[model samples]
Target: MNEAGDTGLAEVRVDVWLWAARFFKTRSLAKQAIVGGHVDVNGGGCKPAKTLRAGDRLRIARGEERLEVEVLALSERRGPASVAQALYRETDASRLARETARAERRMVGATAPPKRPDKQARRELRRLKDGG
Candidate 1:
């Protein structure tokens, strides 16, 4: 049992926690994300090896998706998705916002193909896009 009085909980590195929680595919990627400022621990910037305790807040980004979760438990091993879910509790608003953003981006991307024109348009678009 840990300080939180939960036998399932453990103390682990932030990167490992993120990986085990399924935030990133690998610990290295999680570290990269942390260094890239795409992952926030306890509402502030943290290193990959920062120690994470139960109830800590994490904001993680995967591509265009962002997630906010509260650490419910900690595990160092990469386990199954179901097991991973047991380690954290995602906020409802975060889930909804991520889904909506993903849908909106998908829709925009799908419709954006026609917006790109030929070579002439490319030159003009570049000028406009770059504010040149």
Candidate 2:
């Protein structure tokens, strides 16, 4: 029995762990994000192959959402949502910030115009573009 079997994991690659934790849909996406400098570990940038263990701190940026999480466990294989959730614990501040930003976006978006114009509206737009 190895350490992996004894404790589920001894350590895991940062990108692999992110994918296993469901942060990224695929390992390739996780690797891309890591290589692009979208992830930080222990307040410092790390390579995709960086080894992560329990208690490690991770700052991950996924588009409009940013997360600060403390590693709680490690796994090399992706699992169900409930299982994945156990692998890391999110900080309250990170959760609050993400929710607040989402709320603000919703409030501001309510007053925005529809994404696509109607046929009549397009004609009007064309006329305006043509300077009458």
* lDDT to native, each model: 0.83, 0.90
- Candidate 1 C-alpha error for residue 72, in Å: 0.6
Error of 2 at 66 (Å): 0.5
User: Per model, how many backbone clashes are there?
Assistant: 0, 0
RMSD of 1: 7.7
Q: Which digits, one per residue and each the tens of the lDDT, describe model 1 over residues 4-28?
A: 2233645688997888778888889
List model 2 lDDT by residue over 1-132, tens digit each.
222212467788999899988999999999999999999999999999999989999999999899999999888878788888888899999999999999999999998877898899999999999998
* Model 1: CA > 4 A from native: 1-10, 115-132
Q: Residue 98 of model 2: what lDDT?
A: 95
Residue 48's lDDT within candidate 1 is 87
- Candidate 2 achieves a global lDDT of 0.90
Q: After superposition, how far is residue 19 of candidate 1 from its true place, in Å?
A: 1.3
